[model samples]
Target chain A: MTGLNNKIHQALQQIHAEQALKDKTKAALKQKIQQYEKQKYKTEKRRLVAILACLCLLLIGGAGWFYFTPATTISIDINPSLEVGVNFFDRVVSVESYNDDGQELAASLDIRFMTYAQAIQEILETENITDLLSADEILTISVIGSDEQRCRRILSDIESYTAGQKNIYCYSAASDEVATAHEIGLSYGKYRAFLELQSLDPDITPEELQHMTMREIRDLIDSLSGNKQNENASDTHQGAGNGHGQNSGGGNRRQGR
Target chain B: MRSEQEVNKAIERYADTVRRLCMIYLKNETDTEDIFQTVFLKYVVSSVSFENEEHEKAWLIRVTINACKDVLKRFFRSHTISLNELMEQPEILEPDHTEVLEAVLSLPLKYKDVVYLHYYEGYTAPQISRILRKNVNTVYTLLTRSRQLLKEKLGGDGLE
Candidate 1:
């Protein structure tokens, strides 16, 4: 090579000799390689544990959701106006009310965690409903917006509840009829009128009343009032919400909003 | 892939060459050690099977060059560590040798690399082009320009 290249070569040799990898640096790199190999082994183990933990959490969460959530919601609207939510094991887990009377009834009774039968017994004993019920009066319990399976479960529970009880006949109205009643702004009043109308005429069944529209129920109530020549009968039916003290033999219980 | 024993031997053989490349690129112990560890670690873990010692040496040199480039690119427009910081102890050299070495280091980054590969490492222009992934003509042009710049900086003694 040339003189300059020769000189550079000599200088590079000196720098190379001076800058050899320190013994400490070589040992440090060897240690790092060993650590890297060990880390590779643990990576798979850690990832598998993480996946298993995630699966366990998912299973627990699914079981909790299935157990805690209500399987059926039974909305009883006999002017007492309460919704009883039953779990998979037929235990009442929730009681919600849509009106003032139901609110008072809900507060007076802590029926949660009781069996469906016990809860219905509690509902019957509450002054909220007992005051509204006459000896021969039919209690109309309707299922709110729910699936067919849940509706069947709720209806079955109510039947079982009223079987042993005396003078308490539980009639189930269609969920659609209840929805229509709610839509018409006088669900509880119309439901009470329908029940009274049913008891007056044994031919007019619960299914027949459930099928009738709100206008039909109103006309039927007016015609029945006229036939009885009861002047206060029309007032009781019309002013059910206003005259809470006048318990006019059947038709007048305040509609729950 | 080299066996563990082979890898250890290769590390001993080429560790100084990588250290020199890192010194030329980065001018601090921290940066130098970082590149040194990376180069050896790659040698230990790489799966490529070299044809021979020359191929293995060339691959190591290429990896070293690329590693140095990465370090420099990280701080390209930011602060550059000077060669003064790199020279742990000034080697007692003849005036010509010291002056030439300083002039080469003072050259631009691309030119400094080509000059070091050609002169210090005794690599041909074509070999440097392959190692640096540069065109042969590009390497020759850099060498020419760098020699000219060094001539100006160190007078006639630059690349005589």
Candidate 2:
């Protein structure tokens, strides 16, 4: 048995793998490894591209949101009650109307993306607005914002530009007050007039006042409060022009020069 | 993936053992070449870390045997070859050694691994059982039957 085992071992020892076979296998394995590395690289590159594309989409969408979001609102009320939304850059981003006449006026104006000053100028120069001004109608411009300093700057700029015009009142109010005004479907100007009238008459409704001009609402408030001196006055009334217009309904009234 | 240096070392060390196992199972040079590539390629891609040289040798032996069986199971290929093509340089083998090798190769497929491992590789029945994943008693029975068969093929005198 030992001799048989030794002979089997000796015979097996004589058999060695040729050098050519080992070389061929090493060459083949090297080629396969290269292919594997290339495939891995391509897969990683594809993943990186997908991530970059998603980031780019998020950046574009965020910029669009930043450019279009409103930071301050200017409510213009003179029978046709409407509001213009201004972005952080002071550009008018939206115009919304609360009545049929305001809708018609809004449709006739293309003030989007314009500066608030330009938009207000365009509104005052419109034929309908010019005709109303000539007939002694009151146009109230209310600047609503969270930032008091920014609102005051805007109100000062507006008062200076409309200094020569008659019966155009400019003031600023807090955003919370404007939000309350919007809940009842009234622009901030008409809402202040409504508050004044409500305090005097206690029966004046927003619906009853929606179609009335700012001049008419002021006359109603003056008539109910028995302050008849300001009635039929064609001069402008500037409401304190303080960025915080909390007392704008009664205590803030000032005769315009 | 194994490094190039590691793969070269394994080929140098285990190439003879793999070639001998290939001779035990396959009857042709092409099949032996196929088994060589298949076994070495598996070693290259395998993440198995061995504790020592014995563990690696056992793994290579098992893989070479399985690769041989897989080639044989392919129904499309022929398994027959002339006796001259059986050994790759038959001139080096003495007449007595050639007779002994031919006798071992002619053994039944189930007995070939047991005879080679027990006689030439010096593995006991229990160790062969562990390598082949078989019952220790079953390995002893196979070794007994293979010893009897080898004795009959060669002369019974001086045969264990």
Angstrom error at residue A18, model 2: 1.6
What's the distance in Å from true for residue A195, model 2?
5.5
Candidate 1 lDDT tens digits, A1-257: 87667766776666652335555456766687768767977997899999999999999998877766776656665544677777787788888765665677788898888987788787887765655554223354544434566556565666565554422333333445555555544344345565667665667654455434333554576577565446335434533322121121244443321
| Each candidate's DockQ | 0.39, 0.48
What docking grade does candidate 1 earn? acceptable
True interface contacts reproduced, per candidate: 0.51, 0.51
* Model 1, position A225: C-alpha lDDT score: 51
**Model 2: DockQ vs. true structure:** 0.48
**Residue B131 lDDT in candidate 1:** 82
Clash count for each candidate, listed in order shown: 0, 0
Report the lDDT tens digits of candidate 2 across residue range A1-257: 57677767877666677788777767776676678678879999999999999999999998888889888899998878889999989999999998889999999999999999999999989998988878777888888888888888888888787877777877788888888888998888999888888888887788898889987887887778777676543243432221123333342655455
Using TM-score as the measure, the top candidate is: 2
